[model samples]
Target: MAKTTSDLIVERLIDWGVDTIFGLPGDGVDGFFEALRTHQDKLRFVQVRHEEAAAFAAVGYAKYTGRIGVCVATSGPGGIHLLNGLYDAKCDLQPVLAITGHTFHDLIGMSYQQDVDLDKVFMDVAVFNERLMGPAHAENLVDMAIRAAYGRRGVAHITIPKDMQEWKVSDEQRSKANVPMHSADLAAPLAFRPATALLEQAAEIINKGSKVTVFVGRGALHAREEVEQLAELVGGPVVKALLGKGVLPDQSPYTTGGIGLLGTAPSVDAMNECDTLIMIGTSFPYMEFLPKPGQAKCVQIELDPTRVGLRHPVDVALTGDSKTILQALLPMLKKKDGKFLKKAQERMKDWNELLTDRGTRTDMPMKPQVVTHTLSRLLNDDAIVSADSGTIATWTARYVQMRGNMQFSLSGMLATMANGLPYSIGAAAAYPGRQVVCVVGDGGLSMLMAEIATLVKYNLNVTVIVVKNNVLGQIKWEQIVLEGNPEFGVELHPIDFAKVAEACGARGFTLERAEDAEAVLREALAHPGPSVVQAVVDPNEPPMPGKVTTDQALHFAKALLRGQKDASKIIKTLAEDQIREVV
Candidate 1:
């Protein structure tokens, strides 16, 4: 039999080192599935319960491995379901390729069943989007799509018509007679360095200020040593963006924790007091948490010139690889007194002490911080941990200490729910035998609860810690704190996620009392297969901002006066947590 487009695409995927493809099969893409069956030994297909989970898994795989992730779906609704996850990949700058099926080429514009003009729908989300024209278009199109996804660090999409999936390519079409044959090996990533003159200018700006603070983001993940060196050389405290939480450990003396709403007081203070701000490999979006415009001399080092000065006004913008740029610029820096760093360290010590006290509370309704902090203690040193959006993200950000070789990620830019489990699935797939954990709120877990079966099907060793508060805790607080309104339509019906996990052939543990948290989590994490720990926590615990203004305090008071359902409980929990801080 002659080679078909489906076979050619699968072969090309293996060439590019894609070991797995996450998707759900439909008749529209049966030919591709058949091709996958033939190549099952070479490539694995992870069948997800939903197309969105498939896409999210792909994004997570890319994030963990720094390689292109591939996801597939059928025509129309299947393709549309992938939009949220694909947007997450795009917003976080992860390289992912999405392949979807289409209607027969003959019936494309006739408004046939499940016929979506996917190319048009995908234009804004993908760096490269196309529909396979014919058998001859397969090789070049696959090559170009993968290349575009890698080079641009965004999504690449392709829609294949059902009729064309089995169309055989002639020998001449495979040869260079009609189209140029492409190589399977990917070109090395560009390692450009900024000019020496530009580095010196940034250095001079850094040297001129005594109160320097370094800000790092996801881009600095690989430049940890360089970042530390620069901080040490300038005697500045390093503040991390939420996505860059793992770049430096919270235990480091030169560091304060995260910035923004889910950040620490020391980080906010560092930004406010610094006369010079050095941003490296980050485009942190919370401008309010940064220094006032022109209040600090700023220098931004980024790999993409287009994103160089995006988040702030910079006196010097140097575009290059983060590790390389920092290495080149470190030597030109002058040493300063450690007074600024020492002060920040003092603040961090107080902050850490407060967190420890909060996380160790033995109150009736358990604090969510205790769950995350306990999980942090039980996690393997090199575990890959992911958190779902909502108050769970806040808990994970504040309590889960990143040390050793631990890796952390979440729906950073998209801030979408239901990504927690899928990300763990992807992480487990990326590195088998390594420990993986997903910390999620009840609302987010309920959104994709069926994935519990996916975990069982693969026997992936992932421990999901579900914080069941019986309400949308994050949105509830946002209403009171940010909007000054009484909470409405934010409650979630309680779910016994542990029972659900057992129904899906996984181990399940339930923790209602605060004392049971550590043991329950330890057993779940060591279960050897997929496990779920349903932890019922306090709903009234607030996810307060790092730096709250008087306006926010007024808003909370107004919300309580406007008849919040749990006004009394809210005040009690808030006072308990706040009282600990003052002492």
Candidate 2:
């Protein structure tokens, strides 16, 4: 049988080393689906309930494996649905490829059904965007798209018209004089390193400082050992951006967990006190959490020269991969007195003790912290975890200790809602043998409840821990603390997510009492297939910052005065939480 454009595109994807593709099938993509069916042995198609989830899953897979994740969809709405997830990949700089089917070529400008000019729609999000014109264009388009995604570390998009998918690919097409040939072989990643002179200059700035700090991010994950050595040599705490949570175990002597709003007290202190700031592969946007300008001499190490010194002004900039740059810079760093690091460790110890106290309370309406703290203890050493954006993120950041080979990620800069389940699905697909868990809040999980069915269908082992506090907890607090307004339109009518899970053919557990959190979490985690643990928690509890500013306290008080809902209960919980540390 003669090959078609769809066949050639699929073959090219296989050649580029893509084993999995996530998407939903539609009539516009029927020919492509047929091609996928014919090539089933070489490619695994993960059908998602929503096209959005499919794109999110691709981003998740790319994030976990450092490979070019691929997703597919039909025309118009399906193509539009992919924008959010593709934007997430673009913002985070993850490599991903999105293929969407368009209307028949003749019907494109005739306002045919599902014709939406996807090329223009995807222009802002994709690093490379192209369309398949005929059989001759398939291989070259796919090759160039994948290359662009990898080279730019962003999204690449291709729109195949319904009619084009059926075009024949034969020897005659290849023999055409106008046809251009291209190679589909996968290329090695560029190994970037900074010069010795730049490393020496960074070291000089570090050597002069008495109190230095290493601020790391996801870019530093590959150079854990080097980051640790740099922290030790500089005699300062190692603070991580949220995406960099697992780079060093929380228990490391040189580490202070995460920075910014969802961060520890010790990290805030490190940033405030440090005289020299070494930013390694982290473009953390929270300028308020960092040292004020001129308080510290900054040295930035970034692989993308365009992003170097983007967040903070740098005394020296080293453009290279973190592992190689740190390796070259480490030897030049002079050892400093252990005093600075020891003080930060003492502060971190105190902070950890406080977190333990907050997380162990045995209140009837379970504290959200207990859920994360218990899950942290029950997780396998090699587990992969994903979190949703909400107060649940605050709890996960504070309580979940990343150790061993455990991996963790969330919607870092995008901070989108309802990504937890899809991210776990992607992680499980990428590494089938490893345990995967998704930690999310009630509101976030409800946004994509249908994905639970996807897990059951695939028989993917994923434990979803839902902190069921019937409110949009994060925004509620933000209104009170940041805006000084009474919470409005934040209440969520309760749904028994456990029952919902059971209805979808997955095991479900509920935790109404704090005492049962650990036991329930253990069972859910040990379940052989998909499981859900709906933990009823106290909504009055706020995601308190490590340090509360006067304005925040005033705003919180003002909101209460303006008749915030459940004002008395909120005050009691807030007071009790704050009083625990001092007493």
Candidate 3:
């Protein structure tokens, strides 16, 4: 039998080290499914309840493994449903390939069922977007698409016509399985080197400033050792963007976790106090948290030249691999004599004491901090956590202590809801036998409750800890800051999520009080199969910002003028002994 495009693509994927795929089968993709069936022994296809879940799984797979993730969907609606998850990949800068099916080329313009303008739909989201218009160069096209995604560190998309799925390739092309280089293996030795003059320019700026604060982001994930060395050489404390949290272990002497709304007070202080800001491999938005233009001498190091000075105008912009750029600039730097890093260290010590005290409180309507801290204690050294957006993320950011070898991921730039469950599913699927935990709020969990069944079907060991605040807690806080709009629609009617999990054929549990938290979570953690532990947390506890400017203080006064009753609860939570000393 002659080789089909599906067979050809699958063979190439095999060579690229893709042993699994996530998607649901549809009529438009019958041929591809048939090809997958033939390759079942080599590549396992994990069927998801929704197409979006498949995309989320792909993104999670890439995030966990540092490799290109592949997901497929049928034409039209099936393809459209993938955009949210694909967008998550794009925003987080994960490399993923999305293959969407189309109707027979003959039927493309005739409005056949499920016929979408797949090219147009995916163009904006993908770095490389194309439709497979012919069979002659189909294999090369697959190679190009996958390479583009992995090289550009963004999404790559391809549209396939149903009729060509079984088309025969040339004898030479169909000879035998010859997989191309795996994306990960190829990327390891690849790096761009900056010019010598730029390194000297950056070093000069760095050496002149006495108080330097280093900012790192996702791009520095693979350069942990180099980043730490750079921090030591510059006599600066390191602050991470939210997605960059685990880049430097919290135990590192100069590390101050994350900075901004979900960040620690020490990190906030570092940004405000530093005279020189050395941003390495990060394009963190939230300019309000940074020193004003000209307030600090800035040096930005990024591989992509276009993004070198994007966040703030820099005195020196060095473009190259983060590890490479820092390596060149390391020897030229002299350690500063200032005490900025020490002062920030002191602040971090105080902040740590404050969070630990708050996280262990036995207050009724258990604080969410307690839930996160407890979970952190229970996590195995190799555990992977998939946190969702909103107040729960803030708790995870501050309260969860990540010490070593553990990975933490969340929807960073997109900040979308309902990604926790799907991301956990993906992480578990990719790394069998490893514990994957999803920390999400009630608002996020309820949005994609159906995917719980996917967990049971695969028997993936994922523990989902739903922090039940029974309100859109983050949005409610935002409303309060936006001049007390009387909280029009932030309330969430509490659902017994454990019961929902039990219905889906998974173990269900609850933690309503602080006393039961450890025991209940331990039980869930030990469960052999998927489980949901719904812990009721205090909704009124404020998700405190690291710093509150005078304008924000004035806005809070306006919020009080509009008579926000919920504000009283937040204040009461803040005044509790656990927070009083810190706030």
Cα lDDT for residue 502, candidate 3: 99
Clash pairs for candidate 3 = 15-179
Q: After superposition, which runs of candidate 3 have C-alpha atoms over 4 Å from their true positions?
A: 170-189, 565-567, 577-583
**In terms of TM-score, which candidate is stronger, 2 or 3?**
2
Worst 10 residues of 1 by lDDT: 171-180
Give the whole-model CA lDDT for all candidates, comma-separated.
0.90, 0.90, 0.85
Q: TM-scores of the models, in the given order? A: 0.98, 0.98, 0.94
Residue runs of model 1 more than 4 Å from their true location after superposition: 171-177, 182-184, 579-583
> How many clashes in each structure?
0, 0, 1
Q: RMSD, model 3, all Cα superposed?
A: 3.2
lDDT (C-alpha) at residue 93 in model 2 = 90
Q: Report the C-alpha lDDT of model 1 over 216-321, residue by residue, as the tens digit.
A: 9999999889988988888989999988998998788889999988999999999999999999888788898999998999999888889977888999998878
Report the lDDT of model 1 for residue 489.
Answer: 94
- The model with the greater lDDT, 2 or 3, is 2
Error of 3 at 430 (Å): 1.8
